[model samples]
Target: MAKSEVIDVRVSRRVLWVGAEAYPLHNIARATTIRIEPDRMAAVGRFLKSLLILAILTVAAVAVIGRVDWPSGSGQDALRGVVVFAVVMVAVFAAQLLKVLMTRTYYALVIETSGTPRAVLVSTDAREVGGLVLGIMDAISNPHAEFRTQIINYNSTHIGDKINQIGGIGNVGKRVGS
Candidate 1:
């Protein structure tokens, strides 16, 4: 139960954890190389719109083909129209495939902190190639070791202070030179 029993360890750029404890902290970094051009979602919207228009056009084309008199004439023209429709369908599928490929280029990084019984902290970060970096410091033991709650409370306080330091938010763990 003493504070010294608990420790926080950072395994890599994506994972952080409290040692000798059950809980873990998770952090994820996203791939940033793939750039999203202006109105990136616009492409997706346009693709969807094209699909809708194509669907309506296809229904109309089918209706027209069904109504035409095949035995008398015009069968050739109808067949040509169907071929064109097939080509359009293929184009739509290709566009969708491209969108998916572009979207997948982005990556994610996750960090998790855990110990003996359970997880303590979990966090996720998404950024471009120059993503945010996190650092972990060694854990300090609590003098009140008998109570688990006291140990957790002390560790939590220290962890918060460490996080603030890592984030450049405030000074932490400073001792007076009295």
Candidate 2:
């Protein structure tokens, strides 16, 4: 006896030909590539966290010292208060400086990637930075990812043709919309 085989046929929604083989467009042949390295941002986050912890510890120590009374005529109590105030001021300054540094770094990274296929690379990096800083260090790193995504999506939709006209990695044939 012989057995019969059944076959199924269906129309694909979209198709793409990379080389000689055709692939369904909806089926991702490759995962979305990430050009930005998360480790760099993670390292920055760790540094900020350590700085914050040190600041908190220093302030606590100063508070403990301020509470104790020393010899009245020695002027040690007044010196202790001044030292505490100075340490608190330094901590506040360090926090502010770190914040500014992170902000500048985020913007620099964003601007550097503009007009490239990895333009969204900046957005992803910024997103990670913002998430880590806001989540871990209580800092406002960069709240621009959503806006950046919107802009990138819009450009990829509308001005994509113009971008392709210029001819680069972001060109039509190489990119999603082209």
TM agreement with the true structure for every prediction: 0.31, 0.23
TM-score of 1: 0.31
For residues 29-79, write the lDDT of model 1, one tens digit per residue: 221122223344666676777777777877788788887779755777786
Highest lDDT against the true fold, candidate = 1
Deviation of model 1 at 71, angstroms: 3.2
Candidate 2 residue lDDT tens string, 1-178:
0121221111123432221223333342221323332354555676677667666866776666567775764456565765677677666756765664554222111111123422221232445434322321211122222111121111121243453355357543545644
Q: How displaced is residue 89 in candidate 2, in Å?
A: 0.3
> What lDDT is obtained when candidate 1 is compared to the true structure?
0.41
Would you list the C-alpha lDDT of every candidate in the order shown? 0.41, 0.38
